[model samples]
Target: MTTLSDLLSDPLPSGLGLSDRQWLVLSALPGMGARRLARLACECPVWPDGWLSRLPEQAASALRLWLDHPQRSPFGALFDGLDAWLTADPRNTLLHPDHPAWPALLAQLPDPPGVLWASGDLTALSLPTLAIVGSRRPSREGLHQAHRFGRELAERGWCVVSGLALGVDGAAQEAALNTRGRSIAVLGCGVDVIYPPRHATLYRRLLDEGGLLLSEHPPGTRARPAFFPRRNRIVTGVSLGVLVVEAAEKSGSLVSARLAIEQNRELFALPGSLNNPQARGCLNLIREGAVLTTCVDDILDELGHWAETPGTRSAAPAVPGSDDDDPMLGWLSDVPTPLDALVTLTGQDVTACQLQLLELELEGLATQAAGGWIRLPR
Candidate 1:
């Protein structure tokens, strides 16, 4: 029974060097997680050796206690298991912040993972990435929007990075792959452990399609609630920006959006009906200055890559819906006009006129404010 601790170990140092072996030892420390290791490394420029010698009394005591565990010790089975896992496949590779193959943006995270376990093409990480995330249970429209954005962005050569959760996240990444476009799935658990179980097929598909799957945790680790939010940081960390399609007022996606803003990465949110409970989180983001994205242009425009980029991969202005071209929509003015006024002005049945107004509203060309619907700048 190989445990995660063993999988993270590198006892014999056969194919491994001393530095990586030290890192594996650090990984095996029960209480010392990424942040503590990062802090220790920063506090002592010459990590591992120098830092271990001078570790504070309390920290050293904790490490000693962990070493006392029957299953953990001077690395025997742990290292053996690790070597086997590494040599099991050519795609299996582990990276740290110092590695040249590590994603540049990811290395900039406040507490970057010291060990990034991955499978598939590591170079694909160099391509600009856009993250798409939302609630695990999203509305139909939300799912549709996520897939549309994912496919479009991926087709334009941007890699779609997302937590491998269901609903919006899965929809987007799957759509990207369906189009034969590249994507990256950041796992909340080990790259080898399929948390959802149902996504077992999708998980293999991702790697089969040359998509990258990454995790900070070692193989054999199971998904935990805390791990998902922690995983969200990496999703946003590796992306140029994060696009939140739909989330509840108190959803985990909101946490990612805040992390993106804190990380100084661009934030984009898709607006939904005020009546939708799932859309409230995105609505709050829009209120607090996240760019409201209606199409790929909304994102590319904000990133300043739309019109100027030269290649087969640029987005064009969105085509206006035929409903927006109706004469009734032209009757709506920038000023708020009453429904009765609109009905009389358009000389149509109340329902017919309302339907047209709704069409224009969806197009971002009109909005109901003050007393009535008003024309809005597209």
Candidate 2:
């Protein structure tokens, strides 16, 4: 059995062979990626055996003068830091392709991350995963859509995957976790470093509740613009499919959608109002042949052949007789719906809406959430 200590201690087989440590060493290099390794392989069919052994003086993903100066290399110091980071926590894991725990889906990516710094359950990476993503500032309807999709998908035993950002990503992942389902957070920064800071509680919940945080960046690496696109690829690549709840014409979520299409992974999007700017991306995607999703079953039915969605939820039946039963049940959901939004949705005056909500709350049919109110799941 390979242990953490043996991870980087192992040596290469022969002159032309590569060791797992060599793989980690190469991965730690800045700008280094699978494509660069591929290019090197073409030149030296037996790589690292000769010119590719360490950081080269000239390469697409090398900083020859900065870190690989002729006098000294930062490789040893970097490994020392990484080893310290690994030892800091028992849950911390640095996974390479050689590790049996590596996600097989990631290996099929065009340029897979050579290493991942992860925490929590690694086994969740093997489960049927669904990527849920969208704009940072979405409409109430968009938020509701994300929550419903995530909850419903998770109820079916699918592990929800997302970036853990401020909006739809957070809403969806939180909803999935609320269902007591597994989830994976693919971070642009390190797994230990929470990007938004606002999601601190969510981050902690993820680990405590058997969720996982995955990162290509080593611990202490800060978030940057370039890192997100890389993160977006993993979100789509690791999942059986991606569902875009809402995204503007130009948004980071669209990047994931595009990557999903490029990878030939199933892409699903929830259609929003035609007037909504955030819906533009999903509409464009649907026009370009992405699946148009209206309900959880739409996704399950379409991806059933490829995705592993096997879970069930007993629907809560509406109460027998409120005698004065309100028509607002159609507007309520597990996701918080602001009173104003509910009023708009139900075409009712504020006073009447509040009264109905109070009645539902008294009947144990609704509960207050941070935003306003949410229907108790049946």
Candidate 3:
């Protein structure tokens, strides 16, 4: 029986040289999980010789056999599959802990993937990244928030990361692509295998439009029930923070939120109406100290320090000096005005209106009340 583990074994291509080959073999060794591999890395063992002494008998034996007699190793077929998978696409590449291009943020995970199969532009990993994750079944409002944040984040030169699931994940990634911006879809299945089937177009567009596809599993591996939860770790692991658009009380997004907190990544949640079931998880997250995100500025305010690069969008926007400088201020009055009304009055999107309102409130020109926004004596 050719198992998924067997499919995980990779070929030691001459192009990769000896060091890369050792890392690949070690990662494919039986019983050599991420935590164990990470622990071994801490020892600073000298290549093959030092590593063999530290590896378990089973894994060490496998490595020794593979090194001396590659043709006799159990992983021969797996190596063939890996070689075939790489040759199948020029964009496809394997990433390991020692790879110079490996994401530093991902390395900080308690148990980072020992190897990653990736497709598309690896440079996306170098950009300032943020994550957007939420319910597979979400409210229309939740979906809107995802798109808004995704578009805004991408416009601000941020690489949006997500699981590329059906609802919020797809919406966010799609919006980012729509703007010709960068995004990385971290899949639970092989980078080549498109699960959920419905996202096939999205999966293709993600790569076609210059986004990256990442997976821990080898090519041809199928998505398992257990893989999705573990995939969330990588989703948050590579980003500065994660924005959960909406989630039910027991939604899988909470798992991501918890992972984000554990990873020490900033957590942001969009508040929804009390009546909506999908809002519960986000509300609970906010209660537990996640940032209550209402606009892109809210996130930028919190994570601005990470995006201070020269060519990227500034964390702070220029403040409007008067009503003439900002048209939104003209719409504000002593009475509370709803956000939608402000959007309608100012001819701007919800996110832009929210950002302007935030600036106004910061300058004491406006304030949010129970109903909506109110003008204050300046």
Candidate with better TM-score, 1 vs 2: 1
Instruction: Write down the worst ten-residue block by lDDT for model 3.
Output: 6-15
Per-residue lDDT tens digits for candidate 2, residues 24-123, read 6666556556656434433434443453454454542343332346236556676777789778877888876555555545534557776788898876
* lDDT, candidate 1, 267-328, per-residue tens: 99999999999999999999999999899988877765321322543332222354556676
Q: List the residue pairs that clash in candidate 2.
A: 315-378, 316-378
lDDT of 1 at 293: 87
Best by TM-score: 3
Window of ten residues with lowest summed lDDT in model 2 = 1-10
**Cα deviation in Å at residue 57, candidate 1?**
3.6
Among all candidates shown, the one with the greatest lDDT: 3
Residue pairs whose backbone atoms clash in candidate 3: none
lDDT of each: 0.72, 0.72, 0.78
| lDDT comparing candidate 2 with the true structure | 0.72
Off by over 4 Å in 1: 1-18, 47-49, 58-74, 305-378
Tell me the lDDT of model 1 at 47. Answer: 41
- TM-score of each model, in listed order: 0.72, 0.71, 0.77
